[model samples]
Target: MNTIGHTIKAARERRNLTKEELAQKLRVGTHTVEKYESGEQIPSNQTILKLSTVLDIPTSELLKKQNI
Candidate 1:
């Protein structure tokens, strides 16, 4: 099963967004974005919402575990 990190990374890549760009939009450090993509950390609900908006994906998509 794909973790949230994997989902986030895929979505971000689909949008052609860099980690730094995503971090800047989220008001976070690039390392934090890295952690999120690495499954070392999980973003809060607010952050998830921001990510959905920034990535142009549905929040439900972000919350769902994908089959990688």
Candidate 2:
């Protein structure tokens, strides 16, 4: 998987959030979340920022970077 997908998966698992649950929280479709996890697509910038907030991590972490 890509770094972005790997990071997202790790964070989601740490938070105990299923794809459906995370999608619901993001107000996006489960397919979107699936694509993200599968590394088929990347989330939009706004979505990444929102996910970082919802997941209680910095955007850099979500981006697979050590610093934001």
Candidate 3:
């Protein structure tokens, strides 16, 4: 099952961006990116919107959830 974090990490990797690079684009720190990717945190709606734009993915993709 894919968590939102997994989806985000996959999208980021598809864009060939490192955690630091994605953080820089999102105006967040590298640790924050790690947290997001590790499913230790969730981003705000505003940040999600920014991520959609930066990652060239739909917001729906970021909002997807696992059945569990």
Candidate 4:
């Protein structure tokens, strides 16, 4: 099963962005990004919106979690 972290990681990869690059774009610390990808933390809704924008994916897509 996929989690939000997996979705975030996949989307970031699809954009060819490293965690550091994504963190810079999101104005967050690299460790924060790492935590998000590692499923150790969950981003706020505001951050999720930012992720959707930065990743060029829909908010709904970011919300999805399933076997992909």
Give the local distance difference test score of model 1.
Answer: 0.91
Q: Please give the lDDT score for candidate 4.
A: 0.90
Model 1 is weakest, by summed lDDT over 10 consecutive residues, at: 59-68
RMSD value for candidate 1 = 3.0
User: Where is the poorest 10-residue window by lDDT in model 2?
Assistant: 59-68
Cα displacement (Å) at residue 41, model 3 = 0.2
Q: Which stretches of candidate 2 lie over 4 Å from their true place?
A: 65-68
TM-score of 3: 0.93
Tens-digit per-residue lDDT, 1-68, candidate 4: 67889989999999999999999999999999999998888889899999999999898887776332
- Which tens-of-lDDT digit does each residue in 1-68 have in candidate 3? 78889999999999999999999999999999999899889888899999999999998989888432
Residue pairs in collision within model 1? none
lDDT of candidates 1 onward, in order: 0.91, 0.84, 0.92, 0.90
* Candidate 1 vs candidate 4, lDDT winner: 1
* Candidate rank order under TM-score: 3, 1, 4, 2
Write candidate 1's Cα lDDT for 1-68 as tens digits: 77889989999999999999999999999999999999888998899999999999898888887432
lDDT tens readout by residue for model 2, 1-68 = 34777878888999999999999999999999989877778888999998898888888777764222
Q: What RMSD, rounded to one decimal, does every model reach?
A: 3.0, 3.1, 2.1, 3.2
Candidate 4: residue 6 Cα off by (Å): 0.4
Candidate 2: C-alpha RMSD after superposition? 3.1
